[model samples]
Target: MELSLSQCSKLTWTLNVHFIVLDCPGTASEQAGKSESCQGCPNQQLCASGATKAPDPAIAEIGAKLSSVKHKILVLSGKGGVGKSTFSAHLAHALASDNTKEVALLDVDICGPSIPRIMGLEGEQVRHAQKRSKPFYVDDNLAVMSIGFLLSSPDDAVIWRGPKKNGMIKQFLRDVDWGELDYLIMDTPPGTSDEHLSVVQYLSSTHVDGAVIITTPQEVSLQDVRKEIRFCQKVKLPIIGVVENMSGFVCPKCKNTSQIFPPTSGGAEKMCADLGLPLLGRVPLDPRIARSCDEGRSFLCEVPDSPAAKAYQTIVQSIQDYCSNRATEVQRAT
Candidate 1:
């Protein structure tokens, strides 16, 4: 909850049962008794009632560091094994393909950092800086950062609690040397939990471009994807669009497409219409796409003419258009 305070005074708030006192810009005595400074404060009741507290201090640093980037897009899936990470890797590669633009792919899935292996940077290590850490360079236009890089071995497991995971996420946002970039595509773990809340809170100051949700054509996946959509709505994050992956299977030799996971009653297109969201595109499943991923090669780059690759390009174009339109609106508002 947000309350606009018109006056400056000492405010006492509790966080996790611990009391924290903050000195506002006005008189100190206003916190105790009625004063001129507290007359028009919108948050007077909140402060007096001690209902809410200030956000974490690291948020400011996160915002400051992320301000250099033009856009931040989160790639998330409600259910696991939905090809979310693969989509993020391809999206980043496609965006960075333009030599004029810079892009950073941040793998925020602490427990499962698949981006490094998917992007073909498995054994890379993170370089340290005085105040931040350097991202591993993929090329002149592309860079990547992930906890997988910090591990001594690929088989090492990340055993952490909610607070520990949150702290690491804060560190990633506040201390990463992203430099100036056109986009930062974050691949989040499946589900809305501590990591998602932490990332959203840290980036509150930065205007996050939006989120791209991924789902398959099955009802089971769509059910979870529905919850993911509601999570975005509850958090007020704009849904740029949705992509239906593995919607169908394409034959390599026959050049024919078949619905492997055909919708029983409805699919992404119908669901999007019901939710008032745009169905970005449908990506048919192809064996070459999986083969490319396993080989740590971008299917989009390796087989640009494939049906799945073409679908990805179409979705990327839609996202670019959305961002361009949002930028124009911001310029007009300013």
Candidate 2:
């Protein structure tokens, strides 16, 4: 009875829940009763049936509560400085590059958020509009939320205890205006700390789904990544697969490929093989990739023909296949 009721509720407000937003200058804590509905009301965007802009947040609220979104994936890494954020940024850009799907990137990495920089948009923060806080929309197909965008500067270090961090993330999940999303990719901070625990626990409570572990080809990194897999299994979170980053570097001058990270070096793929997980794709080290990041542009979105771009696309396609097969497998299991 409850499930049927929930589905019906989602259908009832499907049209009005999704709205586009741009951030304004203000602190989230200081802003109260502030909105930018005048900019672009969602009711106007949701339909063309002569439906005027909605005056209430109820429609969007219903969409959040009841809508069965296609997927909520976490792009995770076992260790820090592993290009996990880059992987996430590219995955999202690849997914939404077509402008056919409604995609969102949720930066749960409160300590170190790079989504804003990776996506090539800076100086935008989450803003409240139309009686709901809106994710900063970079394009028609993509919306992003991150502490990096909210913080005044990149070097601005946030110092808060565990419970507070958890509460803040929960608030993002609960209050921020995520509507009728085809996918929500959460980029998590490295380490199995309170931040990670909070995220996994919250998703478990909400049935939000699983993650993709990012790792390098080095055995040392793979060792840490293996611990991550064990951690996921402990928490009952599903492992989508493993993404091998910095597999090899190709020289642009001579078109020569170099084995910067040894093949079977870290045994990441072997670990996946032993554990029965998919090998999503391998990414190479590209100087232009780092340059693009330094320039604050998404490598894939800005330069689609770049090696980084193609690598990300392959990973995106692999994920698409995984989801398709997983869905079918689920149906059969049931």
Candidate 3:
């Protein structure tokens, strides 16, 4: 059943599977004109104020939608606290900064949905549509959605079990109103948990294109990255390579670089070489980045001159280069 809304006011409708978001003023006219019921829309009744809530999104239906989307990439790591979410947010932000492409950041880390906060969007939720949950825009080129948006407060915990976590992820892939996107960056939670497995399961079936594994230069984190790579191998999910984060720390006083974590077993370069995947790039432990994120700001604009921002730009550019070169290699082999 659909909710019959009388204007976009305080008229409450029981929560349904989906809500008629298109019932709003101008959008309603456009959608109604395209629907099968358009021919019989009498007296302009549909747009004349009395509108109803749309049905909830079918579970599989939403997943199918995501599967069809082009350039869906899952960002994963073997462990937590390696700034995976920050990398996801910045990467999406970098892509969105370009006027040519569309970008979306899906915070699959439901427990600590940091993308909303990292991208300078905190305490933001879906302004419209009470029934069907959807994503909201961070800006023109970039749009973001996270469970954090739905929570009553930022401190709230999801507290879901396996089945529930799995369902929530499936819904995230399916139901969040992600429009046409050029790149969809999925930030999975740390480690191989139910939630992480769910993201992989969803994307692999929904035609997930590839994955980017994030890790720090420390041996502790790199060990897990290798395992994560192996897991992808078992699942047949394409690996795009690894990113070394918090690779080093930069000084503000004398500008000296210091090691934060123990060097990886094979070092960053050798580890990638051994794994036979490219070492995407290494990010220094820059305080500006953490400060910016904590303050709910995008350092892309503010810290372009900082080490972290430059590294981010390099990472995105390198991804483009790697993709282009790989395309060339494929064409040559063909």
Candidate 4:
């Protein structure tokens, strides 16, 4: 029996275990509507509510595509305005600044694509080659991509639903031509949304090296960060560690550091201790860091001797150590 997409509704198994192919929701969903098998799924609520879906990611395709990339790191924050994106940009910049390693920065923050602006590639567009889009090269060692590059203007808004967002992220992972790279740093939007879930699903085969969570010193921010940590735990994503951004304000004239947010008594340090996670480093609140970001300049280059720059270097070193150790472990297993 032949059926069109309109005619096919439920996904069922016939006698003798014959598979009945129906028009899927285009994603792996366990909703108890068209598919009879879905009715018996334990995670029906998770699928039906559209909170998260277990999509059948193209593992082989993604793995082949990202085979050359040595490491894939995701920068995330449960709360907004924790400087996740800024940290991502600088981290990539710092890595690429090494001159020996190749780095790629991918901005998956669909609604608010700021990497193009932050990286000073606002007007740059993604070029195509053999059907695969090429990432914008910031330098010989650095490349970047963002939905901002696809937009007509930086001010243009991306009003998309969850499925659309997921599709775009999938395209980024599958279609973008990111040759060999030392690191592919993804700057995700605030909170665990469709983008975060999609990235994890698609790259499950390619392997996400780990996640670096960013947070401020205030209790309001730390409280939300706790949720971010839990999200990683639930998803089984190994967290590299926590970074305490804006930990203190460095005085420009006197070369002094002050506790601006006042660490909420225990703050990030104590929180990390309680969670048994490493505190990578503390990034001080510096006006120059903001100025460098706004001007599309590399903060490390502008203020190599600054305390914040030194902190970033320390954090980057810790990340390198983590990646190197993981690589060694994989080799031993093989």
Candidate 5:
């Protein structure tokens, strides 16, 4: 019997198969049934038949469409309110600041699409001409695409299921004409869900630079981040690094620094050390950052001399360095 998603979840539960199955040879892999980890799995036979391994035609189509994009970076967070979208917006802005580089921002957080508002393109709608959709431009170099642009009202809700969400993501990847881009930053919804899997699967044929995981200093946030790391590992996606947002707060008047979230367990630095990951940089809580985001302005430009801005620049530079090194390695290999 073909099991539904719910059924598969229940079976995983019954078999005590943790969602973070570290050794799981993905169902689409050739070792699906042959691997020791698949021995007692309920869907072992079905996966072994190679039925689920059939590559989606859209994957190739997407790869072709995004061939001109030099680097594809996914901004992910295990929980919301970690400034993942903010980081994505700034990353695009920073890259486009070069003027010579073209940058694109794609928001895949369908249900809770905030990129439109965050990027100050809330009232903007995607223009369709000759059956092709064009992303909205923030400037000459920065372009953005999000489901938020499709809705008639910013107050509208996108009540969609897994299949619908997946289809929409496919359209975004395949239909949108990004032209040539130096970087394509995708801001995804929190957690390891259908959207995450869909994007990863669709971009499988493309050379994805990697993912930048965002998190706060709190242990609660770190716990979910660990699961997210495992999800990336299981999917075989490279992790660029981890960013600790709202790391601390510096009082303007007193020049005193305070641990706002309080990294109960040594925060992202300790976590990164433990996991062998890089701690990109810690962004301090700045009221101006929030104000700038709310007003649809670039915080880096708004407060160029602030420590938070410096931290962002440092982190963005680190990401650029990583992408440059990756490109060099690819070129050498080729």
Candidate 6:
């Protein structure tokens, strides 16, 4: 059983080729071929040649395209059905309410883009011009873009792989004419997937204000949120704060409050405390909120006096403060 080092290496590679392929250092990675896992991979030689290491010129192009955008914010969630898109829509609406600020909302959830429906632009299509494609404008100041608009029908499925999804996101950033936005809010899909990676990479040269993570009160949502937080940290993206959605439900008849999704393990507040993160105000579960979204209307305008609306106003104020403070610091540094 005493084998030479070369024999041992060959045996290891042979035994782990499948696993190594699954987790290969990408061809663009500097460690692509040098890593031990690349011993028997098919792309080893090509990767080792350093051909794929060339930087994509699109990153710079996207940065320049979005230079007119002042604050870029990504709204993310750990899991689906957590109202990530709803928050994104409302955030854009609230920001544009001032009429002085121009806001753009870009939905990069390629697989299940709900922004079009939620934003009342369901059947809208992107208009191509001489150079840049124009996004559908919700109003004079608010513009919206989503893969939903490209689909012939809302029911059509986008069964694209990672590469295609990444390409679409790149086009959204580089091709769309956002045109001097005060804020560009990207409504990202759940989890740290290809879409998330593409947006972060494409905006690397740009100054991203931060991300607003949305979560429910239950422990299940909190668990996934921890992973999201780690992803943001690894990517060096700033965390503006965490918003606890559906924290509780209030009775319209009696004005009593009840925990709809009970925070079994102390919810986002406890989680934020443990992680030293800011706990953005919690939004109560309001049936009217769902109705407004279904009807493609703004809940803030519909129920401005409701507790949920008030909570949103507070959270949005916090975000505005954060962005203003960040801009001040950047100015000082410059």
lDDT agreement with native, every candidate? 0.83, 0.72, 0.73, 0.84, 0.90, 0.90
Ranking by lDDT: 5, 6, 4, 1, 3, 2
Better of 2 and 5 by TM-score: 5
Of the candidates shown, which would achieve the greatest TM-score relative to the real structure?
6
- Over 117-192, each residue of candidate 1 has an lDDT whose tens digit, in order, gives 8888888765444423888887899988889988878889999988799888988888888899899999999998
Alpha-carbon lDDT of model 6:
0.90
TM-score of each: 0.83, 0.75, 0.76, 0.83, 0.88, 0.90
Model 6 alpha-carbon miss at residue 167, Å? 0.5
Off by over 4 Å in 1: 1-52, 127-132, 253-256
Worst 10 residues of 3 by lDDT: 14-23
Candidate 4, residue 20: the lDDT equals: 20
RMSD of 3: 16.4
- In model 2, where do residues sit more than 4 Å from their true spots? 1-66, 127-132, 263-266, 329-334
Clashes of each: 1, 2, 9, 0, 0, 0
Query: 309 in model 5: Cα distance from truth in Å?
Result: 0.4
Weakest lDDT window of 10 consecutive positions for candidate 4:
15-24
True-vs-predicted CA distance for residue 260, candidate 3, Å: 1.7
lDDT tens string, model 3, 196-216?
Answer: 666765564455657788888
Candidate 5 — what's its lDDT? 0.90
